[model samples]
Target: MDHDIDVFAKNYIYQKSILLTKTAQRADWDREDVVSELTLHLLRRRDQFNPGRGSWTTFVKAVVNNRTTDLHHQLSRQRATLSLSDPRVSRVAERLEDIERLRHHGVSIDPESDQCDRTIDLNNVLSQIPQRDRRLCDQLSRFRTADAAKHLNQCRSNIYRRIVSLRKEFSSAGLTDYWK
Candidate 1:
């Protein structure tokens, strides 16, 4: 597979195209378009493959599945054509867009329309972090990792260490879906 990426890709596409028919039907997308999207994704993310961890097929399969789901979301968003000009409808639409944007950023919100629960949950979970670590997360939101490290007077590795510990706590608290 070292020098035969194209050959491997062609073989994979031929084998997988049939399986993607369901994805096409569910997402209201074209089979050819889905195949093209997955092929491009594989090429772009090929360097992420780790031979020691798994085979190329496993990695490609995972990527293909993820890309297919993303395609579904993309198609759903595109097909949503609400022309609600009412004040309440506009507000609801704005909130829905905000929720979708947050989900895209890996912040899991409750599926229900009540965003208050999401806000409370997010605050409760974040409160578990130490003040210093919370500060690091805030800085991370506003800066690159290196810049955040500099601002915090810590090494880059320390920043990463804090992030890992923070995420572990988030996962332990059953907020894993919100860990980005």
Candidate 2:
């Protein structure tokens, strides 16, 4: 009769160090949010708790573990979805670093390599984008968002929207994983 949900929620967050888990951190969840979700899930599954199979604590703990993982996965997906449409900081240095690493490794830069193949595919996808948007895309490639906005005689917000649309295009082309 002592199935106190509040106690388990607090202990899970603190003594169990659920919040300290790397996945939880990456999910960017606050204590209240996690607890709220945990409570909701536990309440909904109360009827499924089998006292005959195991004790209340055991059932609750298993539920907590599973729900924690599920919440992290859901939140991570939401974060990725949001960022995919957001104009992020330019990653020009990262592209340069890839070239530097290949040179440092003394690897022959072949056009048929996986990276080159991805690049070719990406170019093909870029060409498929509307002709009217090519100038904006070109400006974005060579400059920062603000600078690109200036070059195009448009506001920064306008540039941000264009970048978001470009990301959507890239996403539809199945080139998202390639860039990552």
The window of 10 residues in a row where model 2 has the poorest summed lDDT is 81-90
RMSD of each: 21.2, 16.0
Best by TM-score: 2
lDDT of 2 by residue, 65-169 (tens): 788778767766664422332334234444445555666777555655777556545666766888757887787668877898888899998777877787888
Candidate 2 wrongly placed segments (more than 4 Å)? 13-17, 24-28, 80-180
lDDT of 1: 0.71
Clashes of each: 0, 0
Clashing pairs for model 2 are none
**lDDT, residue 130, model 2:** 85
With candidate 2 superimposed using the best TM-score fit, by how many Å does residue 2's alpha carbon deviate from the native? 8.5
Tell me the TM-score of model 1: 0.35
lDDT of each: 0.71, 0.66
